[model samples]
Target: MTRHLIPLLVFVVIVGFLWAGLSLNPREVPSPLIGKPAPEFALPQLRDGGNIVRAADLRGQVWLLNVFASWCTPCLEEHPYLVDLTRRNLVPVYGLNYKDQRSAALEWLGRHGDPYAGIVVDAEGRTGIEYGVYGVPETFVIDKLGVIRFKHIGPLTPHILNEEILPLVRKLQT
Candidate 1:
């Protein structure tokens, strides 16, 4: 009876810990960057001209900070939507190109439509680490005061844009 009871207790503890881990890791992360200042970053662009973009430049305007990499397959799927977003002028989109070759990143952008207003080359993922990025294709919506208003994890789909992002932008603008 004692042996059986011990195993049951151990199993329960394991299950409890798993549940805690999942619950603690917010699906979107950083609570969608709400009511917090946008993260600061400065990295050189892979594109020519040697210009760099810093997060500080986004102040006094709502903006989107999208993190992606040329190597990530999903990033490819989401690129055109970002281009569409840029075309509509719905909101400003800035990009973080994570840990990839300069030539490859440049080629990818050139082929894809170059939606981002500015691109940061995070070749070591150090900027991603600063923003708490665990994986590719995470997006953060920043408010005019520099606070992060929302963080979107995973690919950017039209449903997410219509249901979650666009409304938030409207709210922030007002």
Candidate 2:
């Protein structure tokens, strides 16, 4: 009877852990980079590989660094909001073209609409590794002094843009 009871208790504990994990949202996973200086990189521009976009060039302003790939479906979902934000000109949205062929990324943006102030080609994914990118469609909000204020993993929804990203940008701008 005692041996049977020990196994039952172990099973119950495992079930409890599973239940707790299921209750948590993946999107809310905390980023360690927040409030820290953004990792710097100098990469070729997507449109003209000869031209470079360095992280240092954007130091004195609030900007959005969107990490996206042409193959990502969620990137397409979040694109319209990015376009809208660009039109509003609230902040300069910079694109990090991660792990994609240059021509494919160019075609995707041209077809969707080119919404970035400038696009950086992360073709080798070295920049993505520096930023600790687990997947495509991650975004970072960087303040005037080059500190990463927030990171949004996955795609940005209208609710997330309005409620979190924009509000944080506004606060940082002033």
Candidate 3:
């Protein structure tokens, strides 16, 4: 009985430490942006001649903002969905081309087919940090009121569409 209790105590201590490590970081805090205003951003266009895109530009419409990098392999995997989304006319899809080469980003879009209605060039990552982007392939769903309604940290999938996304969009409509 004594030996069993010692192992249980050790397990409890380890679990407590693990919880503290994850719970203390603000970065680990899920976005309070949901049901709140999205942080404003003004990023340059990658394709056009240095035009800027702002959070204000997406008001009065539902939009999907995808944070990506030309170098991120997962971003490549998600490109086809972007194309399909644009094709479906489900929502306006925008891309944040994170800290990367201009030529390489363009080449990626060229090779994969540009699906984003607007591509924001965030070469310095300041805008990405403001949006609380921990990594590439994070997506935010902005409602018509220009509020961030949802955030997905990884690749958006068909299952997510069926489960979370479609439901959120339907809710925003009401």
Highest lDDT: which candidate?
2
lDDT scores of the candidates, listed in order:
0.84, 0.93, 0.83
Which has the higher TM-score value, candidate number 1 or candidate number 2? 2
lDDT of 2 by residue, 19-136 (tens): 9999999757788899999998989998888998789999999999999989999999999999999999999999999999988988899899988999999988999988889868
For every candidate, C-alpha RMSD to the true structure in Å: 4.6, 3.3, 3.9
Put down candidate 1 lDDT per residue, 1-174, tens digits, no spaces. 998999999999999999898877556445534677776877786664388777887788888999988888889888889999999999999888888888888888888878998888898898888778887888888888888888887889998888999899889988
RMSD of candidate 1 to the true fold?
4.6
TM-score of each: 0.80, 0.87, 0.80
Segments of candidate 3 deviating more than 4 angstroms: 1-29
lDDT for model 1 comes to 0.84
True lDDT of residue 13, candidate 2? 100
Estimate candidate 2's alpha-carbon lDDT, on a 0 to 1 scale.
0.93
Which parts of model 1 have CA positions greater than 4 angstroms off?
1-33
lDDT score, candidate 2, position 160 = 93
**Clash count, candidate 1:** 3
**Backbone clashes per model, in order?**
3, 0, 0
